[model samples]
Target chain A: MTTTSASNAGFAHGRALRPSSKVLPEHARGHNRSLVLQTLYRSGRRSRADIARETGLTRVTVSALVADLIADGLVVELGQREETRPGKPATLLDLDRSAFVIVGLDLSEHSTFSGALLDLDGTISARAEVALAGSTGEAAVEKVVALAQQLVDQATVPILGIGVGSPGVVDLGGVVLSAPNLGWNGMPLQSILNARFGVPVLVANDANAAVLAEHSFGGADSDAMLIKIGHGVGAGLLLGGTPLFGSRFAAGEIGHVVVGTDGGAVCACGKRGCLETWLSIPNLIERLEEEGDAARTAVLREAGERLGIALAPVVGALDLSEVILAGPTELLDGPLAAATVETLRNRTMAEFHGSVTLRMTTLGQDIVLRGAAVMVLSGQLGVS
Target chain B: MTTTSASNAGFAHGRALRPSSKVLPEHARGHNRSLVLQTLYRSGRRSRADIARETGLTRVTVSALVADLIADGLVVELGQREETRPGKPATLLDLDRSAFVIVGLDLSEHSTFSGALLDLDGTISARAEVALAGSTGEAAVEKVVALAQQLVDQATVPILGIGVGSPGVVDLGGVVLSAPNLGWNGMPLQSILNARFGVPVLVANDANAAVLAEHSFGGADSDAMLIKIGHGVGAGLLLGGTPLFGSRFAAGEIGHVVVGTDGGAVCACGKRGCLETWLSIPNLIERLEEEGDAARTAVLREAGERLGIALAPVVGALDLSEVILAGPTELLDGPLAAATVETLRNRTMAEFHGSVTLRMTTLGQDIVLRGAAVMVLSGQLGVS
Candidate 1:
């Protein structure tokens, strides 16, 4: 299928990319500083005058913020802009991409927890992993902390912060509400990591983190969902460049949502015909194995159709423009993805939602880790 | 059902109601003014110092903004406060609730196009309606204009603006993308009304308009959906106090989404087993009449289950806290609403989304009209 993965294209009509909000004077300085940094981060090297012009801030304000950023070592003076009909070549400034590394941990894997040292731009510089070995509760938490510490130690540059993408419903305060596999419920993971590492620690659902990675790094639309079909079927969502955290911080937790009227297999959540039962890796594998290669395409198509049934209301309700499937390419790319697109078209108002792009994500197994980096970048520096 | 319809409660966790955004100095004055107005609008009467304290704005800034508002006749000094503390009693200020009236038009009804003159508080001061009289195309457009003119004439106060809740896919630019029922395809409704009335005109889909009214006046959670099941079914969404207009301004166009795997009735949109076929007023009434009272509960329950099947993914995906049904309470309340709640609980992860409130709107038939007023208030004055 020809996928229309235009970056931030869905937000082009009504809302702007990061629309400015009304601010009090108390917040203006910090907001403007982030705006200047964001301008530089997104637009590459730009002079103080250019930053002021783009952000609608006065030159004086931009200069002061730039000076502070430079002093903080978060920004660096890049020689000068190439002269093009200017009175004088203005000195350029940009993010100091090499000055700091972020430690990111992905706790969504079934057998092992992975960690990475990622640069400011989400590039993985170093990697580490520790097998779960049937670890649960405090033991699993310890392994995560050890992995983060190892990644932190491997970083040649100063560590900016640590971001963890754990499985389950993670609240705004980074409390793991529930992660059955990890034997966690209401665990204060963010505070624990912050106390241990003494840096800004951000923890979110792995799917939530992955969506951010897709939003910030991958060429996904601003109004998009990144469905992560791994051990369990979950999704991450970004609406107008902001992550949506629902009432219970259970936003994007679509794994257990029953898909079709005709119920089938039972889910681990004790629900019959949950999307996870049809789409989760183990469930799909077992079903395919049971049916053999003769039913391979049929099995994949059926699973894909079920996913579409689960997603149709989401697409129709939210008017989401892009859906990026993050999982095994061999399973999600061809027949399954095609069937999903067909199902969506058949279900939604054709004229309005007919063109919703459904595609497999370019980021593979490291999506959650890289998304963890994005979480840190957004939390600490206010830039992603 | 015991409903948890706390006003704006869902937004209390992560995002604040109207969170401050980064702004340049040029935009700060207007933003602060809106903040002050919004504070008084939500909190009744308050002194300038109180507004400043509540908004984190400087006392001097608040004083200036309040003065400007008073000069504009949008706000009024409501005398001195009844002393509850030591020192001189501060002067209280508030929005002039009757200073200006808004003209609201609801073009969703099949037989009549209705209009109302509403006060700043969304109270309908006067109402008018023009029968369709078999009008379509240009004739229908003319009737809408006539009804608006009648309402505008009835307004004893200066008109703030004209807001229309039309039935169709209305874009951000106020153009009706397609309202097939009214033979409107890409009609420039807002512009036409603006050119005639010489006031700010805002047009939106009827359901979209209704949701805004619920969000602003009906004590709805900030993250909620208002399902309008009239001649056809549609939905209006508010996420964090902002209306969601999808990629094609059809974010809440859920009427046509095929609900179940087992197809049944064919819809006007040429879809099988669409949510509208099960949930629309015409469809429900027809089914109930055909099967008589014996099958009334069963038919309603089945329709409600289908509605839940359509909504479970949406609830799980967005983590929405409330779903308000806006239509005939006789048809939607009791069994249908209860079945929807039950289906939602059964389909979704019960622990996380068990409390998603499904309730009928108290606004009754005036919902779209009052919602139009909200559109006017939000568009012209930045407060809803």
Candidate 2:
């Protein structure tokens, strides 16, 4: 079912890989500088002229900013490159990897933590995971702190800040409003982590973090929706390269959107006819166990169709170019995926008829961890 | 629910007025200057520092821009103001009413009309409208051309640009992909109007125009969803003070979102369970007429609840602070509006709780036309 060839390539071609420079506000010069640093980090070492050309900033501005960055020890000049066609060779610049490291943590229902040692350019130098079975909030906190300490101890770089992506609604102040998966509510996550680690800690919704990660690194450019059809059918929206938190930070709760709206299976969120009731892996497994493979296949197909219909309005309203599926390959790569693509094609406005694509995550299970890392980087850098 | 107070004083309180400076892209300094000029035109005379403070630009930048504007004969110094302090009174600036005019056209299913006059800040100095019934595309074009000529002939000011807002999927190039209501498909509206009007012409979706108007002039001050609950449930999204046009031009088709999957009223778009099928005025009227007034009231209430639920995901996703309802107030003001508010409050996450407010359109019938004018200004001045 890997039908992504020229169509995906063309879609990629049509999209601008870098955020448009025209949209950057002048007052956000610092933000633009961070963006340039991020781009360099993502693309490895590049010359000052190359960075300026890529960022759409004047060479003079880039030079000044680079000089400041070097003076601040955030970035370093990597000597001069070999002359290609000119007399003088240009000096290369790179993020000072040893200057600072960001710690990323992901907390879920079953898993207590996953930590990554991210460098100045958001590169993960090391990673570790820990289990948290039957752990209370305090215990979980302690465990996470210990795990972070271990990760930091392993890292040869200086720690800058920490970012935590947990399954729940997180406020701007890093308070977890509710994490039903973890049976948490009103948890002062940032305060606890900050007190323990003696550093700034940022907490964000896992789905939002994942969306940011996908937008920043996963290559789903343009306004894209990342549907995580795993234990639940949560969605992450990247609207114009930004995660939409909505009025309540509940914007990506596509799982609760009633697909059937009548007598449908009840969802864990105490809702009926939720998309997740039919889309989740356990639900699919239960249905398959009860009704055999054929029925299960049929149900999955229908699930895909319903999901497509459910998302039709969002697509129509947002004119998104891509919908990235991140979950079990067995589900997303089969008839369910095909049905989703078919429904999207048929239901969307004719103008976007063949333009939108449904693609699977290339990062697979690592997406959550990477997304959590991205959350930390973005938070520390003030990108989001 | 007439709840006006000193807090609701127009333009004085930040919340009661659109933040004029928030949407201006940093690069569009000239556009920002023009916006200030337009604001002064609409609001009559305003002091220089007031304009700067209102526009969120640095006072120095505003002064420089205003100075240039005055030199260009686009603005005039309108006498000095009495200082609250014992210092010299500051000189006030106002839009030169005789400088330039803009033409705003509204093309709906029932009407093809033109509005012309000076938009001194956005205030209409003189206005005219023309009706086009039983007119073919060519005939409509000719009529519009004649109407524009008539307006120009009667005008005492130079014209800047012409803006037309129609119910269709319009591309940036002004090509109308389809207007099922107006029987327009793939029409090169911009080129046609440009050829006839001899001025820059902008063609955009009516909903997009409405959002632009709300963002520029209406009381919208934050991330908002302007739902045009007229004949259809079209929506315009304002994210971070910018109109969010999705990948294709199909964003804001909230009408097509399925509210029910099993069985519901059939929509004009050849779909079932569409939000429009239940919430639109015509749909409500039909249901009310068929089901009696009591049943209609109940239905309207239920419809509002459904709309709230339908928008819950969006509200949760974008964390929008306001939902602006634009259409007939008679239908939306009572139980329907209450239901919408209730659903949004109950369905959204707790943090978003008490954060969103649903309000009626302030512009009434002139909304679409004003929106069209805004669309033109935004396009002509390159302000997204």
Ten residues in a row with the worst lDDT in model 2 chain A?
Answer: A1-10
Proportion of true contacts reproduced by candidate 2: 0.41
**Which candidate achieves the best lDDT against the true structure?**
1
For all candidates, the clash counts are 0, 20
For candidate 2, write residues A1-384 as lDDT tens digits. 011111111111112111211222643454556656665666758998998777776788788878877876778888999987967899888877678777888774355577788765456788888888767667777777887888878876566677777776766567787776666788888777777767666677777677667776778884788888776777788765556665555667666655645557877767566677778888877877888876877988988987886776677678788888888897778889889988876665555644778988877766766676666555444332
TM-score, B chain alone, candidates in order: 0.92, 0.80
TM-scores of chain A in all candidate models: 0.92, 0.84
My TM-score estimates for the predictions, one after another, are: 0.93, 0.82
For candidate 1, write residues A1-384 as lDDT tens digits: 001111211112123211123464645665566778788888978999998888777898889999999988989998977888858889998899989898999999899999999999899889999999999999999998899888878879888888889999988778899999999999999888888877778888999889988888888887899999999988888886777888888999999998897878877888889998989999999999999999999999999999888899999988889999998999999989999989988899898899898988888888999998887776666677
- Best TM-score among the predictions, by candidate number: 1
lDDT digits (tens) for residues B1-384 of candidate 2: 011111101111111111111222443554455557556755767988887767666788788888887776767998998878998899988767657667776665356565656473566666677777767566666766777677677766667677776776777677887776555678887788777666777777778778777877787864787888777778888765566766767778777766645557777767677788889888888888888866867988988987886776666556678888888888988889889988777665444445678988787766767776666554443322
Clashes of 1: 0
